[model samples]
Target: MPRVIVVEDSPTQAQHLGFILEEAGFEVVLAPDAETGFRRLNEEHFDVILSDLHLPGDSGFDLCRRLKADPVHRNIPIVVCTSEVDPVNVLRGLQAGADGFVTKQRPPAEILGCVRRVLQRGCAPEPSPSARTRVTFLDQDFELTAGREQLLDILVSAFEDVVHINAQYRQSAVALREANRKLEQRNLELQRSVESERRAHEERKRAESHLIQNEKMTSLGQLAAGVAHEINNPLAFVINNITLLRRDLGYLEAMLSLYREAIAPLAVGRPELVEPIEEYAEKVDLPYTLENLGRLLERTAEGAKRIRHIVASLRDFARLDEQELKEADLNTGIASTLDLARGRASELQVALETVLGPLPMVTCYPARINQVVLSLVTNALDACKPGGRVIIGTCVKEDGVEIAVTDTGTGIPPDVLGKIFDPFFTTKSQGKGTGLGLSISYGIVRSHGGTIAVESTSPGGTRIVVDLPIRPSPTAAP
Candidate 1:
């Protein structure tokens, strides 16, 4: 019987796995922690080892590393069984020499399947099918009676050789079957490669488009700022003239009012009053209009101020420089990114909330960091439906700062979640998104000696967390 070892901390979980393996017709051995697990391995050889990542003392990863480093146990295939299904966890498990990784949430059938495959591989030897078989024949027709007996013995020996040859032929046939299976697996891997390449090509195109859009926006912002400045210079004179004209009109109206008052008292006679009123109206045409010229001037000034404000916003959005490192406040960068993406939030009708914590000034490229924050926030907004909420929080940690952007939006699909950070991989409609935002953000954070990750639930929402170092290390460059 094939022997299988399971290393887990939980009694119920361990027993359940052991029962399943026993039901599968394998001799099962159980260890509750890494210490006992290592002892079990030293005491007996096992076909496969199923280990939980989180054990009592040593972690599954550490155990795997130790096992893989041991010459005696290195050939034993290890399957990591854990509740953690994050990409990082999966990656770390593989890095630690786990031959297979299966989440505890997976169906028992899947776990059994992995166990069977690993044990089958462990028990089987590599097949060599291509070697040719050799055949030799001997004839016994020499002596009469004694030669007849010799001929029979020779024939018997020939028969024995024939049986041996047949056994070798069967072994060769089994080897061929194994070779064919391996070929099919290779073909399947090739197909997956082709598919991955196709996706990569699509991603490249999306990245190009995203870069083009950024460039266009930058150009437009510069143009807008120049036009606003030019217009402001001419508008300043127009505003000044409008103000002076209103002031002169006010003085003229005041003088006319004084004249009217003086004339009203002096001209008690109807003929004199009529003549004075006609003369005043002819002098200034004050009764010809009732519009407030001062109000018009005020409205003009307000419009100009609004235009200037818009221009300033545009300038801030477009400001980009060569990647130069400097000390910067992360909170300021977050605020600016929010301002830049305000339009996107408005379109989605998503409310944005920020809880900024006290963070140390970090040396990083301000523009690049801003771009990263903007990309993350934009992605969060895009994921959300109308009336959804996005929360941006930041805090200082022991070695760095953590920024988290969370959204109450449609969660990521499980199948495509792993490829989210791959360039050009998008879940949006064609022409809607280029899908390079997260990839670029990931790159920027890495450049700053930081890490970025996502947590999400299907049909629920997603949260992106970024941890950045406070100071850029010269030797630890990204």
Candidate 2:
């Protein structure tokens, strides 16, 4: 078997090189440094010397120069093994009488191939140069005494290695670009898929939210209807009894007046009987009581009517009777919303005002319109302080009617204003908001071919305006 010595300062590199050469059917001798390698080389006859450039004591360059100068070891071929790829270092290694050069970064097979090629070349004839050549390279000066053929061989070999490395780099570069292109394509596909899934999820969530709000409105309508029914029956009898009592009180007053006329003549002779009747009348204050009784009944009836009006407003707000598309007065819807939100306004001490202008009836989903109005008004009230005011107004537009809810509250922050209609977005404290009010309202308005927008008002306030078409296209129908 061909014998080779590997001089490497690193134990791992020495073992690795040893393994590769031994597996290639070569006898391997491992040396930790140049001193040990030099001793080994002098003691034994080796076919090849694979020495690393970096050593503990003398470097591989120094060892090569010393061996080439010695008569006994001058014929042995030396290959410098290193990780350094600097052209200056390569030239220096070749100038040191190294027959071949291989970098550690090269594949193991390439390193082994380099050694085999040198072995095949055997030994070169010694040349005596006329004079040493002094050259300046990369701002450093070096004096070399190698023959022209040796120098030519070194340059050609280095140039060949450069050409081979360049070809490999080009192929690697092409492969890498193709890989990156495919990776980019894959990433784009993944992004598109994720975006599509996100849109689907949002659509599903929107549908579910609409359904839940509809069910809530339906349930509210049923409850309101039940409450109205329960209250109306008793209210009817109370109203009837009040009417009857007022009529009977009028008859009794006339009869008492006639009795007073009849009793006046008896006052002189039947003084005791007239005196008892007059004293009882004076004690009871019958004259004042008879005068105020009519007014009292009228006020009581007015209060009962107010109660009835409120119940009607609740039913109107829920609008169970009008579920489909129909002509609805926007002003009336605003009124119903105001009525429903009145208690909350009162509790919050927020003033509620209406600037209702003449408006043409808009064909829309009445319940949905009412819901939009209620949502806007409720949000307005919530944004306000105790002394703040909310104004709900309706006006006629050229193509439709506009409902505006303006509040004297802190205006929405610039950053938060844009995302107000985004689903599940809210500024309210957790548990206090579901964050779907404006989103649902926006959907509702759009379904009716309407547009809802908001703007900041003067002196820290907000105004939400909803514009609804009088008669929407068929596509807008829910």
lDDT (C-alpha, whole model) for all candidates: 0.73, 0.86
Per-residue alpha-carbon lDDT of model 1 for 49-161, expressed as tens digits?
Answer: 99999987899989978987787887787777877445455446545656666667555776787667555544222113332222222431211111223223334433544
Candidate 1 stretches with Cα past 4 Å from truth are 1-160, 163-310, 321-323, 457-459, 475-478
Alpha-carbon TM-score of each model against the true structure: 0.50, 0.85
Error of model 2, residue 454, in angstroms: 2.2
lDDT of 2 by residue, 1-478 (tens): 9999999989988898898899999999998888898899889989999999989999999988998888998888888887756788876876787888887766678778888878877556555564667777899877665656556655765776787688879999999999999999999999999999999988987888788777878798899899899998999898899899889988999999999898978997788889989898899898888888888989998988878888888888888888789988878877877888999999999999999999887889888888888899989999999999999988888888899999999899999998898878889999888888999899899988889999999999999999888998799855
Candidate 1, which ten residues in sequence have the lowest lDDT sum?
A: 140-149
Give the per-residue Cα lDDT of candidate 1 at 436.
75
Top of the candidates by TM-score: 2
TM match of model 1 to true structure: 0.50
Query: How well does candidate 2 score on lDDT at residue 137?
Result: 89
What TM-score does structure 2 among the candidates reach? 0.85
Where model 2 places Cα greater than 4 Å from the true spot, the runs are 1-4, 8-32, 55-58, 104-130, 255-291, 429-432
